[model samples]
Target chain A: MSPQRSEQLLLIPLRLAAMSAAVICFLIVALLVLESLPALNNIGWRLLSDANWRPTPAAADGAFRVTPMVVATLVITAGAVLLAAPLGLASALFCRFYASPSVAVVYRRLVELLAGIPGVIYGFWGLVVLVPLLGAWRPPGASLLAASLVLALMILPTVALISESAMRAVPQRYVRAAAALGLSRWGTIRSVILPSARRGILTAVILATGRAIGETLAVVMVVGNIVRFPSGLMEPVRALTGNIALEMGYASGDHRSALFFSGLVLTGLVMVLVLFANRLGHRGAISDA
Target chain B: MLDRVLTQPRAKCRKVTLPDRLAALLVWTVATLVAGMLLWIVLDLLRHGLPHLSIGFLLDAPRDAGRAGGIAPVLVATAMILIVSLAVAVPLGLATALLLSEYIRRGSRFAGFVRHALEVLAGVPSIVFGLFGNALFVRYFGMGYSVAAGGLTLACMVLPLFVRASEEALRSVPDDFRRAADALGLTRAAAIRSVLLPAALPGILVALVLSTGRALAEAAALLFTSGYVLRVPESLGDSGRTLAVHIYELAMNVPGGESQAYATGVVLLGALLLINLLTALLGRRYGAQVQGVRR
Candidate 1:
């Protein structure tokens, strides 16, 4: 073959792979929607509005209510993000402004390592340490609060790293401008630096929220999967993810379909958060330019 | 950094401000907390996990439903799954990345669409992948909960990460290098192979490392598709359990295997830490992506 022909052939495979990359979401969406068809048809909006979860393969009356799971998912996400966002933003500010350059570099690398460590390990640590530690206060220790704390730790690195990057993108001239205006150090950070980096920081929070929503194993390890609407931070709650994971192995019939439906709901919820996050991230970038 | 302080002569003169000191203290405290969290987990893992993690624990198969003996079969299963996933993801990821970065125009609508797709892929949760894997590979394709099914599902999960990071890596290579190659009368294929690939090699390697970390640490996607049978896998079709799956089962299935779960957790943590350290070293050596840790 001619060199050009060989090049064309090489291009074919790469193009195919790229096409695959482009259509992966289509495949996933199709699969989730198709498999979830039965559950969606049967459960309808009850999955959204109902709070009860009963799985009886025999009675065929087992309702896979999604309310508690959805509520728990939101609650866990809120609790974790509530703790993570502020601390993460603060740490980002600290690393960006207060730390010397060498120290900042090391801090960033440590955050990377923290990010690279997987969710299962976080879950494991939560199971062994956090749960028992919380047991002192809450007895079972595997409460919504413990899961929230673990998730807070799990997502802190993401929020901090993204926040740091965003804060770093603030032009030095602005800080200098604030200094010229006789603004104090904290004043400059709060007034000049944060306002400039606001879009990026919000994007980080959105991304971190998505991370918390999608997180499964770590949340499962700590949160007692009791399938009840959480009454308080110390109460046990089952998230949408925990429900799918718990029953996916041996669940059959409508029970199985219900699990898949929960997966669908989760997919929908996470995709929304992700889309919002992407929008904010793009806005942040555009504003930066 | 000091230059900024030095340049601000007025601020530098009265450097001992309360707010500055407070910000310094708070920042240091947060940094220390972050650092301390990492240290405490590892130290606690070592304390609880070391005694049970013997050579027998690694080489021997489980004797009593994971209550006693080693995790050799889990090791084999994890190895098989990782190999299958790596095989599928690495080639597809690099090719797609190359196509996006080199073959496509930078500002084209098609490129934007592809980027959007990869971003969507990244955001899709692993448990959702679990459901999709069960539907596509397990039921529809009739793979029947085999390692093949799990591995393929995981491949789908991490392929976007591979592509996104690798594209960033490829794009980071200066256009001057491609121009240099073009001046030498090389064809597009040859230039990409000889010049582009070399320049992007480190970034590509780093991408591989990140994807590998995701694959190895994954549990949710594998939970349904892989089928948690802690037996040594004989082939790709055999139902197998990874260390993550084993730990999940042992840790959650009540009180019998708690210590063993902790030991396995240590092993899992070690495996992950090793990959992370390798990624750090690669980033340090390659002079790329020290700042770019993808989600």
Candidate 2:
């Protein structure tokens, strides 16, 4: 066969493959919308606005609002990010500037190991170890605190690795110039590196936040799965993810559609996050150029 | 000015500033604490799981709602699910990646859209994927709850990750190889198949290993689509539990199933560690080869 003909032939399959991603994205949105239509039409915006979620037929109240769960999700995610940011940034700075080459390599490998650990294992560990420890201090160990702590550990690697890369991407000449200016190492890092790497670090934190929001099994296992809003760190609270996973097994009809609606909301939230990250990434690229 | 600046700080530079010292101490403490946490998790799992983790435990089937017995069936289901997901994801991912790196221009709208789609897909939670899978595979397609549905759902979840990694791998192949292929009158397909794929093989393998690790660790995505039936899956149509799901169920629902859950957690962690080691080895090999070429 002619080379051009072969190339044309290959393009058919390649283009089809390339189209798969867009097609899948369209299909997932369409399916979620279609499946959740029943509930959306019935419950309308009340599903999102009200703070109740008693969807089971057995319950005296059949309201299916997710405001409280959404709040719980945000709370745990915020807590995780708050806890992870400092630790992760510090670790990233350590790996990039503080640690010797060998130690950095070993340290990075260990963090990567932490990154690779399955969410369920973290959930398992949190449930068995951390929850009980917290429970010792405050009764009912499986609270927002336990869940946030687990999630913080779960996302720490992402934050640290991304921040390290961001810091690494900063030009060496800038550091040299800061040294030429007689700035101390930390001063240089603070004034030169952090400012240049700020966008990247923010992107890392945003991505970690997105991950914490989407994580289900890990948070589900630890976050006491109570439907009410958490009054404190020690109180049990159910997140959007936990609600769906814990109830999806037995949910039917509107309840099931409501669950799908929850998924839709979760997907929408992450989409915004991904777009934000993409914007930062593109702006950073343009600025660098 | 340069001489003055250098001379002025020459003595001062010898003594680290307080903030520098404090930053060093903070980073060191945090790194140590993080390392210690990892160590504690691994040690705790081993301590709890080692007694229950035996050849028999791996081979036996749960006799009582996972409160008793083992995870042999779960292991089979996990392997089968992984096989199905890889079967779907690898070809699709490789084709999509090739299209991106070789066929499509970098700044084109289509490329951008595809990338954006993938990023969105990657950021979507596994639980949402589970719902998507449950809706499309389990309900729409009439596949019901089966390994095939679960695997296909996992394929959707991992496809973005796999494609992105594979594209990076393909892009890492130096442009010289393409030029050389053209100089030798090699067809595009021939050059890609023989030259590019071979060069990028290690990197692609690393991607595969990493994607596999993610899929293996998933439970939420598989829960609704795969449907947790504990019996050994006789076919792709059979519903079966994965190890992660088994761990989740045993630990959360099944009272007195703590030891079993610990053992399962260990197995899952061990599998992840094994995959990470594979990735490191493959990464080193790829790094060496690329460096050799550069040199």
Candidate 3:
């Protein structure tokens, strides 16, 4: 065959593979929307407002409220981000600046190892250890506090690794210049290096927040999975991901659709967060260049 | 003379004061905290899990929510799924990567869209993928709750990772190799197969190991599509439980299931650590090869 003909033949397979990936994305979004439509039509927008989640009998045109679940999802994710941000940032700083070369390599490997462990393991660990620890100080064994702690652990690697990369990308010249001006090593890191790397760090935190928000197995294992307004860190709460995972199996009529609706909400939240982070990451990259 | 005067005061001030001591303390504290959390997780799993660890527990099947049962079936299932998923993913991923890096030019609109779509795929949560597997594999394909179904679903899950990694590896190959091949009247396909692929193998291997680690840990998607079963899988069509799914089922349903869950967790953790160590060893060997080539 001529070279041109062979090239054309290759394009056929390439096009086919690319098209397949696109179709997969479309199918995923379509299925999520289709499953969610019934609940969307039934509850209308009121699903966002009503706090109660009692599903009346199917014959009674059951009311399936989502307000408490939404609140719970936001609260748990926010709490996790709050817990993770400082520790992750500090670890990132230590890895980038304080650690010697060998220690830094070990630290990076540790983060990678942590990141690879399955979420389910974290959930199992949380159920065994974190829940009981929380229960001793509180009432129910499963609570938002337990969920948040597990989530914080789950997302720590994402936050630390991304932030570390960002911090490392800050120009060495900037730090050196700051120090040459009589600023101490700490001052250079604090006043100069951090400000320069702020965008990257922010992007990392946002991504970690997104991960925490959508986490399923770990939080489900510990968050009590109760659909109610969170009373405190000790009270059981249902997150959007946990709700879908727990109920999608047995749900029928509006209940199944409601679970899909939860998935839809979770996807929307993740898309927004991811897009925001990507934008920030792009700008950080440009600045670094 | 002026530079010396400017530098002398800075040196004198540095000798008298610990300017960055507080910041250093803060950084150390943060590192300690992260290290502490990781240690705690490992310690907690061992502390709770070790009591349940026994020969009988490793060999026998789960009996009840509370007591000792072996996880051999679940271990086998996890291994099968991991191997099956990687088997399906690696080739397809490498092909797509080759297409993107070697065949397509950098600025092609088609290439850009494909890249963006893969990023979107990567960002999509695993639960959504599980739901997709439910609709497509189980419902449409009539696969039911089989290892094949879960494996295929997970293959799609890791496809983007492989493609991205492979593309990156291919991109790192120098243009000189392609030019030299062209000078010898070699076709693009011949050059890519003989030269580019060899050079990119190490990076592609790293990506494969990473994806395999991910596949082994996944549970939520497998929960519905894999359909947890206590018995050993006799065939690809048979339903089986992974260690993660087993942990989830037992922990949620069984009273004092915590101990059993911990024991299973230790097995999973051990698998992950082993994978990491193996990857590190392989990566180091590959690193030396790349350096040798550079020299």
| Winner by TM-score | 2
Residue-wise C-alpha lDDT for candidate 2, range B1-295, written one tens digit per residue: 2212222223465456787778878989999999999999999999999888889889998878987788999999999999999999999999999999999899999888887777777778899999999899998899999999999999988898899888888999999999999999999999999999999999899889988998999999999999889999999999989999999999899898999999988898888888988888999889999989978
Provide DockQ values for all models, in the order shown: 0.58, 0.57, 0.47
Q: Tell me how many clashing residue pairs each candidate has.
A: 0, 0, 2
Positional deviation of B215 in candidate 1, in angstroms? 0.8
lDDT of 2 at A26: 92
iRMSD per prediction, in order: 3.0, 4.9, 5.5
Off by over 4 Å in 3: A49-51, A56-60, A282-289, B1-19, B50-58
lDDT of 2 by residue, A164-201 (tens): 88887887778778777778767777888889999988
Q: Which CAPRI category fits model 1?
A: medium
Question: Candidate 3 lDDT, tens digit per residue, A1-289?
Answer: 8998897887787778766667777888898898778777777776766546766425136657788888898999999999888888888877776776678788877777778778998898788778888888886889999999899888988888887778767776776576567865566666887898899888888888888887899999999988888988889989888877887666677776777677778878888887787777643332111
Per-candidate fnat, comma-separated: 0.67, 0.74, 0.49
Question: Which candidate leads in DockQ?
Answer: 1
**In model 3 chain B, where is the ten-residue run with the lowest total lDDT?**
B1-10
Q: Check candidate 1 and list the clashing pairs.
A: none
Better model by TM-score: candidate 1 vs candidate 2: 2
Candidate 1 per-residue lDDT over residues A1-289, each given as its tens digit: 8878988899888878887866768988887777677776776666665547887553247656778888999999999999999878877876777767788788877777777667887888898889988998768889999989999988888788777778768887887777766766676777877888888888888888888998999998899999888998888899889888888888876678778777777888888977887777643332111
List where candidate 1 sits over 4 angstroms from the true fold: A1-6, A48-51, A282-289, B2-22, B288-295
Two-chain complex of model 3, DockQ on C-alpha atoms against the true structure: 0.47
Best by lDDT: 2
